[model samples]
Target: MDLLDFARGPAINVAMAVLVFGVLWRLFALLFLGKPVDRTIPRLGTPGPFWAGLREIGRRMLPHPTFATAERFAFFNGWVFHVGLAIVVFGFRPHILFIKNLTGLSWPALPSGVIYAVGAITALSLIAALVKRITSPVQRFISTFDDYFTWVVTIAPVLTGLAAVGHVGARYETLLAIHILSIAVLLIWLPFGKLFHAFLVFLSRGQTGAFLARRGV
Candidate 1:
């Protein structure tokens, strides 16, 4: 095979392997190690059923839900950070092309400027969060090694992505290689660290909200 064909095959295979294994490992670990329903803290004043959880998520999403609190800036910043990060990670042109080529699916790509803006915002937000964790006594006390590991792992992809775009030390292809390697490291680390919370957060939020609703709190 030509160099292009050979490179494509291994790139696709490695990426697929990492994705599949990372997901499975996370699923199994959560199944085995995740705390039971009663262990989760529920939101106060929630009402019961699966809908309660849905309502909680809706409240978080909406401009003003019944459970809305006065911490408007915090909520807005957090949401913006998450949404922007998602857009950059999942809506990059190269990523879309890779997915379409490998999986026979495609999505619209974000504009380059928008993607760069999202990357910048997400990186800033992550740094702010890390600082918060270090400076806040309560957060510092609550954080475990896993939490720190998650922060590093999560930040790696963003940093590498920026480096790939900037191409500071090497050719574009070399920067891309570094970016892919960082991503691979993150995938391998995800299951073994607090990064697993990325998946568990949704389920835990839902279950906790539902339970609170049942208690009429």
Candidate 2:
């Protein structure tokens, strides 16, 4: 098959398989790590672990005041791109159709104009995120190769999706194929990279919350 055919067909299928299995593997491994029994009875009036964990999930969405000043930029920037990405991914007509085809699920799409605008904003936010990461002395000092690589993988689909829509640098067919390929690459890399935090962050935050609540912290 041609590049476009290969990208849309086998490559995407394989990537999806990897994403599903990789995520399941990680989750199961974490589960099998075995929760430690807390001998300390929860302080009187404290919520149970499940409730405390749920509460913590919401609490950790915002920065603690002590670190808010330092974290505010990243937090806001992350929200902008994250929201924009979600809109573009779930609100675009073509993407909705793809979802329907894959899982027999579909939703109404936003206008093409809205999708385009949101996609552009998402790409710009991603660029700002990269700039922030590289320019911040503390963050840059602590950053590893994984940080930058994951960033690239995360942003590739966004950039390519915009490019495909705008028909930038290539014919529409070619641009579309490249966009699909970028998405495939993202799916393949996600579970193996820092992006896996997308799944783990809530779990970790919840566990911490439960632990602290049990101790009456």
lDDT of each: 0.73, 0.90
Q: Which digits, one per residue and each the tens of the lDDT, describe model 2 over residues 1-217? A: 8889999899999999999999999999999989887677679999998999999999878888899998999999999998998899899999999889999998888999999999889889999999998999988999999999888987888888888888899998888998899989889998999989889998999999999999998
Index of the highest-TM-score prediction: 2
lDDT of 2 at 157: 85
lDDT tens per residue, model 1, 1-217: 5433433456546755876788787688767885555655555655556898887666556556543574454566778778877898789998788668768888888898788888988989888888877987887999999889877877777887887797767777766766766666676676667766667777777866677686675
lDDT of 1 at 43: 57
Q: Point out where model 1 deviates above 4 Å.
A: 1-19, 25-48, 60-74
Pairs that collide, model 1: 45-217, 46-217, 47-213, 48-213
Error of 1 at 32 (Å): 9.8
